[model samples]
Target: MLEREELKLYNRQIILPELGLAGQEKLKVARVLMIGAGGLGCPVLQYLVAAGVGHVGIVDADVIDISNLHRQILYSIADVGKPKAETAKQKLEWLNPFVELTAYEERLNTENAARLINLYDLIIDGSDNFTTRYLVNDTCVALNKPLVFGSIFKFEGQVSVFNYQDGPNYRDVFPEPPPENEVPNCDETGVIGVLPGIIGTYMANEAIKIICDIGETLSGKLFSMNALDNSMNVYKITKQRQAISAPVAANLAASPDREISMETLSNWLGETPDEICIIDVRETYEFDDYNIGGLNIPLYELQESVDIIPVDKKLVFICQTGQRSKIALQWTESHLKNEKYSLKNGIKHNL
Candidate 1:
């Protein structure tokens, strides 16, 4: 049902034998939801809109920072401090006025994950952290939706399609999230500027193929690429239906009961500094560079040094973001009888 103007606009793609008018129509009617508007999201959003995805929804609560300009190509210096989803929507609409775009300027949490995901036919994850990635994958599995997943670290990138046609998913590959300290994100370990572009384009290609029914999708395999060495590998992954373990259940629960906001922590520290004990669970280097006055106890050493933490004071655990702190909170809750809390969203949000 393409109008005259729409046909002319997509003439180049319409000419392809594998994707003629019918395929173009399929693209026109497809609904896509992108989880992040960061490094990987920039290219995926650009190509999807240019390819004529009829309806695109962007979900990201982050604002643009000067440091993001290198990999996140959609924004300019002027866009710093602006909400990513809204800025991306403005730019995408200009790229293809034929497509409709919706911007959700909020983070995707457990409470709203299901509802937001249900609104779209496909979910493309461009998230950087394990927490959101796991949440997205689990939600996709629960809703029986296809998820195009991509991640970048240093010069390496990985892409895959999960929960498509009963295929293996993120959990099927990793089973459980890695120890937060074991895996460093792009913020801690820098990525090559073009790595996300390469992987994100592949993700966009998978989405296009899925929508047009053109070729085989990466449903049961993981695609890994190294930009530095130009090495590529595809690994076969199998789904494991084992019952969720206690740790995995704790992660899934994502309870708010143990979380303390930055504002609340600041106020408490100001009024009764002696009553609070902040244990920074980040790596030593991270703590040495910048810290908000806390005892540095790297997550890997927490078990050996658990006894050092004071049980009398209101214990608050913090890490770079919040994933490690959550894990630390779980460990402390199981072993110690102290009043424990995790800084909500970690120190990153506060800074």
Candidate 2:
């Protein structure tokens, strides 16, 4: 039974035919776990709480930083230096007292991901790293829980619902992670401030729809949007009968010569200055997080313009962690003959 104040708070959403009192009550009984308290997480958190999500768990290991202010809307200048999850909890509580918000100020790694996810009915991924994203997908798939996923690059964003009722998980669409150094995080590159807001809202919409069984869920489909052109595209994805293996373990267990690290690319940037032929694998938003100064080529874009990379100089690659940079090195070797490059691990590692 919704309290009088709760009904008043959610009156607008309750009025929608798709989401009347019954839907609202369904929402009140649902528990959503949002991974990452960054850009996408902010908007998703705000809207879900405002819509009366009964229990929302926020998981983020990072603290509020000055640079995050541009896109992570949940915090203020005063909130800087505080734990992101804790800060979001405060704001969400203010947004809807009817909802219960739990803040987990810890990073989600393989060891603890399953345990944490087991506590909630649904998981929303706003995490910027591929490792966490893959982990979320695998755990959800194994547990038979649903996941709402969102990601953003320079001008493009993606939204999808993975592992819903054993529907195609992310790996079903992207069976393998892009080669090392391929996809940079927002911290490594830079993202349009509004990109995450748009994608995150769409993610929130998907979560609500999944909870109430209202509209079409983005299951077994990838929704790609280009904010620059205001054009949208949907690609059908099929889950292969094959089990989705752990991409990281596959790459890590490879031979030494087969193994590589951005920081150990002696063949590429051993002696060259940081400026010449360096590629930033971090996403646009991530590049703005912290940078050692380099070219703004995101990981996803590098494959298309490999020739544009300077051959006269050695190329250095960077990303959120070393994973994407390693992929970039392999791609460069496989495609371009004149491109000389090495990986720089991540900005934090170099710093």
Candidate 3:
């Protein structure tokens, strides 16, 4: 039941023939727990609160960083250094007093995953890492809760509904988490600030649809969009005979000295450009699509002392994941004795 004030606050949306009063009421009582109060979480919380979602929970251990101002619209310079979950709740409470907000200022980890997940009627995975993504999906499957998932890479974003009414869970679409460094994150690759807003709102819309039991949700569909090209796609998701739980890839567990961190590599590139050579082993198409300034030498075509190996420049092999780059190094091991390494976790990061 909505208060007289809530009815007025949401009158515009309430009047929609498809939504009406019944839908508004459903929103006023829906309990939603969103993971990650970063880029994606900001817009989602704002829309859900303003739209009168009655009970909302936020879980984020990260404090506001100055870099977050671009996409985390709910925060400002003044809010920097504050806990995201708490700051969001305090501000969102003012957005709609009719909605109850709770903040858990902590990361969602294995120990606390099940407990926190069980508290909500639905889950919106605003998390940015592959580990958390799979953990959230598995827990949702265990607890029988619907999960609305969204992720943003450099210029593209993906959204889908998992474990909805026994629909294909996340595992069915991505049965395994990509290697830790296979896909670089926004921090490493960068995203246009407005991209998250566009994608996050789509996620919130999915949540509203679920809570109100209206419209066809992306229960068994994957929605992907490229902000750079302004293209969108919706692909049907097929469930596997049994959901396969994927282990977090240990592709980065190689010897410490044998691998390089992106930060160190970036610092080296900036300070001593002549000292480092980043050899991207991904295919020509992949490297052409995106690369962080590196030579494009397809792994399949790699050869010893390939095209006069520079003796002065330290070699760093890179690929989608660190695994293929390792192969590239082995192929060149005998002929090239220059200090070489496989980029720790590859060029792009999933998280």
Candidate 4:
């Protein structure tokens, strides 16, 4: 279950009809293992944590370098010489306190690959090398875990979801790793800074979709995007299809049952005022000027006195823009699990 603060933090996304509370709940329960804390891993980690993935493990043994500050946006010059995994965890904590981040300041190797991958529901290959990529992929396949794969070159990048619901996998797409001599090093060949950012965001998006189990994911398809030419392509990856379990129903619409309008609130007050708890998440100044007679609890201070917000009645959070109210509902006691809602659009015009 998502914490009260998480509801407020992810209010913008939680209101999404496609994602709704159910999809956000799915994201909150997902445990993801990310291999590498380099170019692609940087953005992947940032967004995954921000999106409230329950637990994330970062695997990287490398330390920051002054040169890495460009594409690896998570690090700064002050972070140079610090281990990437630990540094990322430290930085990401400021991004989302609700996410549980673990740093393995060690490389993912054959010895620990299976053990580490076993702990996560999903795997993402953001490593810069083929050896690490192949290892992560094979381990994911063996463990029957879906993998979100991404790679960046100078101006081009590729993204794909492998072994998703028994669909195509990395080995099925690459067949064999390129010869070591033939592999181009980002250090030697040099990569454009913006290239990884574009690719990394795509990888993060794919991870979210995978976690929420929504949309036509890149499963059985490889997406290639080029920055220089401004081009994109989707290539079919051939694999013997396996029977896929029908995914849980997604894109649940925001039901009126979960949201309240001014008219509805007024009716509820007239009929059963004893059965509802209205919380005005606006400031004291705003509540003093006008309110529908609810406890005045500013959104910022909601976490402190959240326990006082009664849970037995139908809870309705209200604010001027409706955004804060959505966040207010999220800040309510998670353990209560009662009927909770946010005023739709706010009581500003209705008043």
Candidate 5:
């Protein structure tokens, strides 16, 4: 039973026609785990806490930075340098004192993902990369849990619910992981601050519908939104293959040392001269905004222009964030298997 103060605290939500007392009660008992405390996580966390989600777990290993203030609205300039997850937990606790907020000030990786996710009823993914995105998807599928998904790029965003009651999962739509470096992150490519907010709210809405058992769930549909046009499109998908292959499983299991932290990358940048061959995979406009000194090659143009890359030099791939760089590196590796190449680390981290 909820205390009188608790009841008073959630009165506005309880009075809603769509979300009545029962809906509020459901939220009170529910446990949710959200990955990432960046742009999308900020809004999702705020509304979920405000709506009285009984227990919420936030996992993020990042510290607040001034650059994050544009979209990660939860943090203030004063909060910069503080651990994002802990700061969010403190703010959430104040928003709904009746709710319990858990903060894991650590990155969500393959080793800890299963254990961390096992404690929750549902998982919300605001993670920025294909690696973490696929990690969460596979883990959620293995546990047979519902996942609220969101991703933003440039002026667009995508939202969906995966692994919900035998619905078409993410794998159904994107059967194979594209060779790394194909997709750039918000930081690498630059996202309008408001974009993640729109996507994050959609993720929160999906969570609410799943919690309350009302409205049409975006189970088999991918919702794409273009901020520039104020347009929304939903593409339905069907299950093509079930049971990921052993090779795919092995790939997931493989811990490649290709990844580096933004801090490590920054350090390397400071120590090394610009003589190394660095390929920046972000769009041209992004090159104009802010970028490390590197050769610009948009992701889509890489395949046709592979000939331009010099064979003798040690190639280092970079992008807005590391996502596209990883893809580009993978593509470069397969095409030039005998060539020597590597990837630069995080674009947003330490920046």
Candidate 6:
């Protein structure tokens, strides 16, 4: 039951024939957990809050940096170095005081993923890495929850609905994580500031439609759009039963062994500067703005520059958020006989 003030606040959306007062109430009862509060999460959080989604939870361990300002409009220069989930909760409360907002200021790892995801009615994957993406997808499959997935790189973005009423999931479409170098994220390729806004709104739209039972949801369909040309395409996705087997779920939940925590890296940089070789695999522009001092070898150029990398020292690869560094580590391990490691959670945690 909406209060008198609540009805007035959402009058515009409530008047729609498809979304009457009942639909508004459905939104008020829906529980959504948004994963990541970065580029894509910004607009999804904004629109859902405005629409009065009753209980919305934000999960992101990262703090804001100046580079995120151009796309993550929910934040400002004042928010730099602050936890994203907490900051989003504060601002979103101001947007819709009637709504309930929860912020989880920790990374969504295997141990906590199921516990956190089970609390929500739907999961929104705004995450940037393949590891987290696959992990979230498998968790949703195991728990039988719907997932609204979105990804953006450069001028293009993709949006889809997965595992809704036994629909195709993320793994059904891709099956395996792409070779990291094959798909460079917004951090590496550089997205036009408005791309996420366009994509994220679509993701929010899917969530609302699913909750209200209005309009055709993108279940088993992948929507791809290019902001440059404003061209869009929708492709039908088929489910592969083997994609969500027990062995696959176990593999997805397993953590890698080559990751070094932020604290350990800091200690090494201080105590063994000569024994450690830090390599920044991010793009040149990212290194120029802010870096912890390392050889700038973008992931694309890593194969050609293998000769310059030292094989004797403990080689540590670093990137904006660690995905590229993991890829760089794989390449270095194959090419050079060195002790390889990747900075866990990436440099974003340090910033």
RMSD per candidate (Å) reads 9.7, 12.2, 13.1, 23.7, 11.3, 11.8
Candidate 4 stretches with Cα past 4 Å from truth are 240-351
How good is model 6 by TM-score? 0.70
lDDT of 4: 0.81
What is the TM-score of each predicted model, taking all chains together? 0.70, 0.69, 0.69, 0.68, 0.69, 0.70
Those runs of model 3 whose alpha carbons end farther than 4 Å from true positions after fitting are 243-351
Better of 1 and 3 by lDDT: 1
Ten contiguous residues minimizing lDDT sum, candidate 3: 244-253
Instruction: Write candidate 2's Cα lDDT for 1-351 as tens digits.
Output: 899998888898998998899999999999999999999999999999998899999999999999999998788999999999998999888888889999998898644676688789999999998778876775665456789999999899999998876578887776445756787877777899999999999999999999998988999899999999999999988876333222222122113453345555544345656535667766666778777666777655665666677766656666665555655564566465554444434555656
Residues 1-351, candidate 3, lDDT per residue (tens digit)?
A: 778888899999999999999999889878999999999999999999999999999999999999999889999999999999999999999888888999999888655776788789999999989878967886776557799999998889999999988789887887557756596887788988998899999999999999988999999999999999999999999976343221222121235687788888888889999898888877677788789877887654565327755777899988876755765564456557788888877876722
Model 2 lDDT at residue 31: 97
- Model 6: colliding residue pairs: none
**Clashes found in each candidate (C-alpha, N, C closer than 3 A):** 0, 33, 5, 3, 10, 0
Tell me the tens digit of each residue's lDDT in model 6 across 287-341: 9989999799876567678899877799889987676575566545547788888
| Candidate 3 local Cα displacement, residue 97, angstroms | 1.0
Minimum summed lDDT over a 10-residue window in model 2 is located at 245-254
lDDT of 4 by residue, 19-71 (tens): 88999999989999999999999999998999989999999999999999889
Pick the winner on TM-score between candidates 1 and 2.
1
| Steric clash pairs (candidate 4) | 4-330, 4-331, 8-327
Q: What is the C-alpha lDDT of each candidate?
A: 0.85, 0.78, 0.82, 0.81, 0.78, 0.86
Cα displacement (Å) at residue 22, model 2:
0.7
TM-score of 3: 0.69
Query: What lDDT is reached at residue 141 by model 4?
Result: 55
